[model samples]
Structure formats: C-alpha cells, structure tokens
Target chain A: MTDALVLLVVVPIAASLFPVALGGRFERIGWFVAAAMGLVHLGLSATVAAQVLESGVISYAVGGFEPPFGIELVADGVSAPLLVLVSLSTLGVLAYARRAGPHSNAFYSELALLTAGISGVFATADVFNLYVFLEITGLATYALVASGRSPRAALASLKYLFVGTIGASLYLLGVGYLYIMTGTLNMADLTGAVASVGYTSPAILTSFGLIVTGLLVKVAVFPLHTWQPGAYAESPDTVSAYISALVSTAAAYALVRIIYAVYTTKFLDEISLAGDALVALASVSIVVGAVLAVMQSDLKRMLAYSSVSQFGLVVAAIGLANETALVGAVVHLVGHAVMKGGLFLTVGVFATGLGVRTVEDFAGLAAKAPISSAAFAVLAFSMVGIPPAVGFVGKWNIVVGAVEAGAWSVAAVVVVSTLLTLAYFGRVIERMYFTAPEPEADAVSTDGGNDAVEVSFGMRAVVVVSAVAAVVLGVLGSDLITVIQPALEVYF
Target chain B: MIDLLTTHYNYIASILLFGIGLYVVMGSPNLVKKIIGMNIFQVGIFLFFVTTGYVDGGAPPVVGHGEETFVSPLPHVLILTAIVVGVSLTAVALALVIRIYDGYGSLDEDVIKEVQVDD
Candidate 1:
C-alpha cells in the first residue's frame, strides 16, 4: 500500500506524458493509454481509501527520510475520500472526452497533467509541494481554457492566468511567513509548531490572512470571482465542465485541510477574530455570487457565477467550523461537483447540437431534446437544493450546522440564496419547456444550428451517470456521512 | 541605520522585489511586462527562502566532519523546486502572451480589450 501511494500520483502524470508525446501518431492508442492509466489511478486511490478507513492514518516517507526533513505523503480520513473524488471525476471527464471529438493532442496532455497536479495537492503532506502542485494545475488549466478557438477564450485565459499567478504568489508568501515562524514545511510538524507558539501572534495572523486571501481568489470567492465567468463562458464545453467541477472544489478542500488539520480548532478558538473574519467574507461571497448569477443572460456564464455562489456556501460552512458544519462543507464539495458537472456536460451537448448560447436560445428545448432537457431539469432542481437531490442534503446540513453555531444570520442568507438560485434556474426551465423558440438568425440558418445535433449515446451515458449519482448520493446520505464522520473526528 | 541595513538586508530586498513585481503586475499595460513582474515576484520568494536557510559564516550543508557549522540545505532544496515551478509558469505565461498577440495584434491589455470591443 505504501509503494502504491506513490504510484497513485505518479502513473497518471507519466502516462499523460506518453499520450502527448506519441499520441499524434496513434490517436486511438493515446486515448486507450490515458483511460487505462485513469482506471489504474482510481483503483489505487480506492485501495488507499480502504486502508485509511480500516487503519488510522497512512504516512509514506519520501526517499527514506522522515518528517521535518524529506517530503511526506499522508492520507487521513480527510484526504482519502477527496483523493478518490479527484480520481473518479478525472476518469469520468476523460471517458467523456474520448467520444466528444478529437481534442488537440496537446490539450489532452495538459488535461492529464492537471489530473496529476490535483491528485498531488490532495495527497502531499508538505505545504511547499502543495504549492508546486497548485502551479501544475494552474498552468494546465490556463492552457486548457485557451485551447478553445474563440478569441474571447484567449482573453478569458489571459485574465485567469494573471489572477491565478497572483493567488499562487500570495500563497507562496504565506508559506514563507509560516516557514519563518515554524522552520518546517511538513504539515504535521507545522501543526504542532503552530499550536505550541500560540495562534494569536501577529506573524501567525499575517500568514493566516495571506493564505486565506490567496485561497479565496482560487475558490473564486465573491468579489474575487471576476475571472471565472469569462473563463467558463469561453472555454470548450468539455473543458469548462471538468474545470468548473474540479478547480474550486480542490481549493476548498485545501482550505479545509489547512484550517482543520494544520491549524487545530484550539488555535482557531484562540484567534476568534480569524473565524469571524472568514465567516464575514464567506457571507458576502454567498450573497454577491447568487445575485450576480441571477443577472447573467448567457447560460454557461450564469452557471459559472452560480458556482461562485455555491463555493461561497462551502467556504461559509467551513467558516462556521463546527463538526456538523464541516461535514456540510465536505458534502457540499462532492454534491456541487456532481450537480455542476452534469449541468455543464448537458449544456455542452445542447451547445454542440443546437448552437445555443443564451437562456433565450433554450426555448422549447424540452420538446426538441427531451432526454437532455430532462437531465438538465434534474440538475437544475438539484442545484436549487430540492429534496432527495444531493444538493439539498448538503444544504440542509449547512443550515443545521449554522443554526447550531448560533449563526442564524448566516442561515438566513443560505435560505435566501437557495430561493434566488431557484428563481434564476427556474427561468431557464420555463424557457426550455414553456416558451416558443425565438427566430434568431443563427437558429434559422443551421437547422437549429448545432442545437439539433443529438447528444451521442456515450455523452448521454456520462450525463445520466452523473445525474443518477446526484440522486443516489443524496438518498444514501447516511453512508457518505458515515465515511466523512471519522474524518471530522480528527478536526472537531 | 547601517546596523539595521546589515541585519535585515534580506528582508528589505524581499519586500522591495515583491513590491516592484506587484506594481508591474497590477499597473503595467503590457501583458508581457506583467509576466515579467510575476517572475520578479517569484524571485523575491526564492530569495526569502534562501535567506531563511542562512547561518552567518556557515559552510554549505554536507554530511562530514567539520560540517557542524553549516546553513541548512532544506530551504535550498525547497527553493530549487520553486524555481522549477517558476520556470514552468514563465513558459505558460509567455505562451499565453504569444497567443494574445496573435489574436489582438498587440501586447497591451487595453489595446486588446479595445480590439475585442471593436470586433
């Protein structure tokens, strides 16, 4: 299992390189290699998760050097499930991409690199290594966004690159500060060091501020979310779906790991101002994101903004920092990924088949494409936190956690946001099912343009699988909660 | 003042470099220049880590007799990894800049935006 852990992070990256290097000559073979590697990666991650559940925590020392010296890869209850989530989602996206079309060989390679980077970030126990993995993910995503043929896509990629660099730089600065205070980069060691020195010190506070601020930018927290809508709107539908599902979720997961694992609840209790400050920022993000999302005309852009709001809820739940709230945040992480991934993939199918870009363009979609539209409706309902969908389970936990934390105001914001989410999504649902199709020029020219393009069986398969996961995950909430609860025990 | 300069020179340099880089990233109109600023900022971080490893008048860290008086090599290794990351970032940023120039015929962000609007 120990050796297998290293393979989990390394194989996908190595395999990704092969496809890009040799894939041009052998297209089918390249995809086969990538898919095979993804399945192997999934299998290894699951094995690790099993071990983590049965045994306490698993630590792999790099190069035979122990903690506070060489780099370490640690998997606890917190990291194990996330590792599985990243691998599973990447595999799903890769499978989806295989039949979608012939993406540039370079593009697919970058996507594979991104998979490795995200997996590394989740598994590594060293803070600096985490930053390196972050860069890998960031660079790959920037390229992926730019791979779209549109000029707007290039522009969006540029903005994302700029902001993302700043975020990474700030995070590095925070790490520098932490290193100065603790003289160690190992997370387990740093936790002990931070607790020993007291969390109220100005240095620790400064580090916390820098780290949290940087992560907020990555997570696309409210005011810092200017780059996301454009990026999501302009990227190829397949790329947009995968990134929208993964990037912010990874950042949120990292933030939780840092706050709960690296800096214990005791440290946070000592620095009460820190928690309050985060809660305040999260509240602002939740309100602002939902409001902005409600105002967008473009379908993908609206979903992108909706993600900004959904992410805010995750951060806010984390800020609440109680056990129930933390579980809510984790559940939200997984739930939002399924719901958003399904929605984006469905939209991709619509855009490809119908050439539709705006909500207005979705008119009578339900009649034209019942199965795809049905899938979208289910996802939309899930996004609105309707019962028996995973979204509701996550949202309900957040509400309960907030109420328990005596944060009734935060709970109220969540309630209002859910309604607002429904209102915006409801407009689209109405347009697709009820309204007459507007005779747009593009619509007239192309036989519904691409909108008439039927989603492939394989594409439909991916959508149905994710949609079913959303419902099933919601129904079996107790099982997920049980898996996650052990993780929460370490933090709370 | 001289004592302060000598004692905190690395700190001063890190801050100065970081500020300059930040200014370029935010204030420059040219996209390429902004990328340059990013590089400068990263170099500042590199310096910060290297400085953290310094022990006054110490030799390089190696396992041998008389190596007791040596600065820690750990930060050096950490900065080495960071440097590789920095290089990768530079490559990606430059690639994006090239693409932007291709799309808009200018490296200036304002010009690019104007071109986009005119389109």
Candidate 2:
C-alpha cells in the first residue's frame, strides 16, 4: 500500500518515456500503453482517496528515508481529492486525444509527462520537489501549446514560456529564501520552523511575497494574466481542454497549500496585510476578467478570459480564509475544471468541423448540431451559475461563505460577476440558436454542408459525460460538501 | 555594517544577481540574452541554496572515515535538481526562439510584433 504512493507518481513518468523510446515503430502500442497508464493512474488515485478517507493522512518517505532529510509524499483529504481530479481528467482528455486522431506521438508522451508532473505537484511533500514538478509541467505545457497548426500558436507559447519562466524563477527564489531561513526543505519541517521564526522576518515575508506572486502568475491572476488568453485560444483543442482543466487549478491548490499547510493560519494572521492584498487582487481580477471576457469576439478567447474571472472567484474565496469560503474555493476549483474542460472540448468539436472561431460563426449551430449544441447550452448555463449545475453550487457556496465572513463587498462582487457571466454566455447561446444563417452563402453550398457540422460520436460522448458530471456534481452538492468539509477543516 | 555584510554576503549576492537577471529578462531586446539572464538568475538561486547549507568552516559533505562533521548535503542535492530543470527550460526556450526567428526573421519582440501586425 505504501509502495502505491511511489507507483502513483512514477508510473506515468516511466510510461511517458517508454513511448518516446519506442518511437514510430510502435505507435499503436504507445497509445495503448499511454491510455492504460491513465486508467491505472485513475484507479490508484481512487484507492488513495478511499484509504485517505478511512485512515487519515498517508505519508510515504522516498527510499525509506525520514522527512526533514529525505523527500516525502503526503496525501491528506485535500491532496487526495485533487489527485483524483488530476488523474480522472487526464484519462478523459487522453481518450479525447486518441479519438481526435493521430497527433505526434511525442505530444501524447509529453502530455503524459505533464500529467505525471502535475500529480507529483499534488503529492510531493518537499517544496523544492514541487518546484521541479512545476518546471516539468511548464515545459510540457509550452510544448503542447506550440504543437498547434497556427503561426500564432508558437508566439503564444513563447510568451507563455517567457512569463512562466519568470514565475518559476520567482518560485525558486522563494524556496531559496525559505531554505535559508529554516535550513530544511521539507514542507512539514518548514511549517514548524516558519511559525517559530515568526512572520515578521524580512526573509520570510520576502519568500511569502515571491511565492504568492509566482503562483498568482501561474494562476493567471489579473495583471499577470496577459499570457493566458492567447495560450488558451491558440493551443490545440485537446491540449487547451486538458490544460484549461488542470493548470490553474493545480496552481491555485499549491497557493492554498502554501498558505494553509506551509505557513499555517497563525502565520497568516500575523501577515494580515498579505491576506488582504491577495483578496484585493482577486477582487480586481474578477471584475477585470469578467469585463474583458464580455468584450471578446472569439469564442475560445471569451471562455479563456472567463476562466480568468472564475479563477479570481476561487482565489478570493481562498483568501477569505474561513472554513465555508475554503470549501467554496475547493468546490469552485472542481466545478470550474469540469465545466471549462467540457466547454473547450465542445468548442474543439465545433471548430474541427465548422471552421468556427468567432461568436458570429456559431449562428444557428443549435439547429445544425443539436446534441453538441445542447451540451454547450447546458455548460454555458452552468458557467453562468444557473440552477442544478456545478457552477451554481460553486457560486452559491462562495456567496454564502462571503456573507458568513461578513465580506459584503465580496458578496456583492460575486452577484454582479454572476450576472456578467450570464450576459456573455447568454449572448453566445442566443447567437447559436436564434440568429439565422446567411441564405446566399447557404444557397451557394448545397446539401446543407453546414448540417454536417456535427461532431463524431466519441467527441460527443466526452462532452455528454463531462456535462452530466457537471450537473450530477451540483445535484449531489450536499454530498460533495460533506466530503469536502473534512478537507476544508484542515485550513480553518 | 561589516558584520552584517559578512554574515549575509550570500543574501546580498543573491539579491544582486536576481536583480541583474530581472533586468536582462525584462530589458534586453535580444531573446537569447533574456535566456542568458534567466540562467544567471537561476545560478543565483542555486548559489543561495548552496550557501545556506554551509555551516561556517564545515567540510564538504563527502561521507568518509571520521568526516561526519560536514555541512548539509540536502541543499546541494536540491540545487543539482534545479540545475537540471533550468537546463531543460533553456533548451525549450531556445527551441522556441529558433522557431520565432524562423517565423519573423527577427529576435526582437517589438520587431516581431510589428511584423506580425503587418502580416
């Protein structure tokens, strides 16, 4: 059982290498092996979750060495849920990629490596190891984004790499500061040392600032988010969907861990200004991102900006630092991943067949591809926080939590942002269903060539599954809250 | 002031190097120079960590007969890993730069942006 921890992190990494090693001679074998590895990872994560729920936290020291000396992997309720989310989403995305037809085998291999790296970020107990995993994930993501056919794809990827490297460098600098202060790299040990040293030390504060800023950049929070819309819009559809689901979510999770696990509530209380600063940035991000999203003409770019808005909501909830708000943050994290991933994948299907990118291109899509269109409508409504959708549940918790924390401004922002969200996506829905297609262009194209714009069964399956999951997760909101409560308690 | 300098020499150097790196990454018009700046920045971090592990006048962490009084080996190991990650990033960034050069025939971001807009 303990060895399972090592296997969970190691298997995907090892498998990622195998496909590359085999090269083109065994492409089918590579895909099979990659898909199998994803399934196995999902199974292992599920097992880890079950054990974590039953047995409290699970700690595995690498090579049988003790912590504060050797690298350790720890899984608490919080990590377990994220681990499961990462694995399951990887599996779904891998399936979608396979069905989408032959991409470079090397790309899938890198995707697997990225998945491994993200899982390692969730699982690793050493701060420096987290930095290493972050690098791996960043490298893999740049490659994935640059794999797109568009010339702009390379430019977007380059920008992402440049900003992302800065973020990574800042993170390393922060880790260096923490190491200098504590003389240890282990997260658990650093937590005690940080508390003992107190938060007033210039070194600790510098580290906190660097780490939070680096993570904010990674999360694409507000001003640092300039790289994201381009990266999200230009990447290959499957790549965009996978990254949309996980990258910022993982960064947000790391931010929460740094605040709650590494620094603790006591340390945060001392740095009252830091917490308030984060909340303020998150507030600005929500309003700014929502406004920018409304102005976007490109459908994918619109959703990308909307993600910036959604991430702000999640970060603000985390910054609030109450149990209810933390729960809201966690739920929002999961909710956004499913809804955004589904929406992106659906858009991918549309773009693949219809050659659509802008909002106007989607006119009358609901009539052309009813099932995919309907799925998009459900997801769009969910993104707007409409009832019986995961987005609604997430927003409801966040709003309720804000009120409980007596953060009336945040509560009001949440309501206003929700309305803004509905306006943008509602406009998209109207364009898809209500607007008429140009008759002259239609007459020039006989056989109703537009009617062939429907997605394949497999792609439709992925959309339906995620769409259903989004609704079911919301419908079972109480159950999710119950499960997430234990995780949220650790923060409060 | 001298005592503070002596005690925190590595810290001062780390900040100085970090600043230099930031200057190049942000200020340099050349793409390759920015990458070089990134490398210098990473080296600064590596140095900070290595220095943190040094107990004053302690021996190297080569375990031997009766040489158990050495500085910690952990930060050294950690920096080695960082070096590998840094090198990997440099390789990828350089590859992207090459691609960008191919696309725009220029390495300056402003020039590239101008060309892209013209296109």
* TM-score per model over all chains: 0.96, 0.95
Instruction: Give each candidate's interface RMSD in Å.
Output: 1.3, 1.4
Query: For residues A1-492, could you state the per-residue lDDT of candidate 1 as single tens digits?
Result: 577677777887888788778876886666677678788988989999999888968889888998778889988776787888777787777767776744567776777788888888888888888888888889889988988887678779988988988898888888888988898889888999988777887888888888888888889998888889999989988888888988888888888888887887887788778888888888888888888888999999999999988998998888888889889899889889888988998988777777777887888889878988998999999989998999999999999999999999889999998998998899999999999786674456356554334457778888888888889989988788888888788777
Q: Chain A: TM-score in each candidate? A: 0.96, 0.96
Give the per-residue Cα lDDT of candidate 1 at A6.
76
Worst 10 residues of 2 chain B by lDDT: B60-69
Residue-level lDDT for A168 in candidate 1: 82
Clashing pairs in 2: none
Q: Once model 1 is optimally superposed onto the true structure by TM-score, how far is the C-alpha of residue A89 displaced, in angstroms?
A: 1.6
Return the TM-score for candidate 2, rounded to 2 decimals.
Answer: 0.95
Tens digit per residue, CA lDDT, model 1, B1-119: 99999999998999899899989989999988898998898898789888988999898877664755899787888889889988987887788777778778998878887898898
Regions of model 1 farther than 4 Å from truth: A440-442, A445-454, B1-3, B63-67
Residue range with the least summed lDDT across 10 consecutive positions in model 2 chain A: A444-453
Candidate 2 C-alpha lDDT tens digits along A1-492:
866777888998988987788776875666777788899898889888898888878989998889878899988877888889888788778777766743577887888888888898888888888888888889999988988866678889978988998898888889888987887888889888998887899999999999989989999999999999999998888888999999988888889888888888777677888878888899999999999999999888999999999999998987887778888788889989999999999998877666666786788878878888999999989988998999998898889988998888899998999999988998889988999877654443343335343456778789888899889988987788877788668656
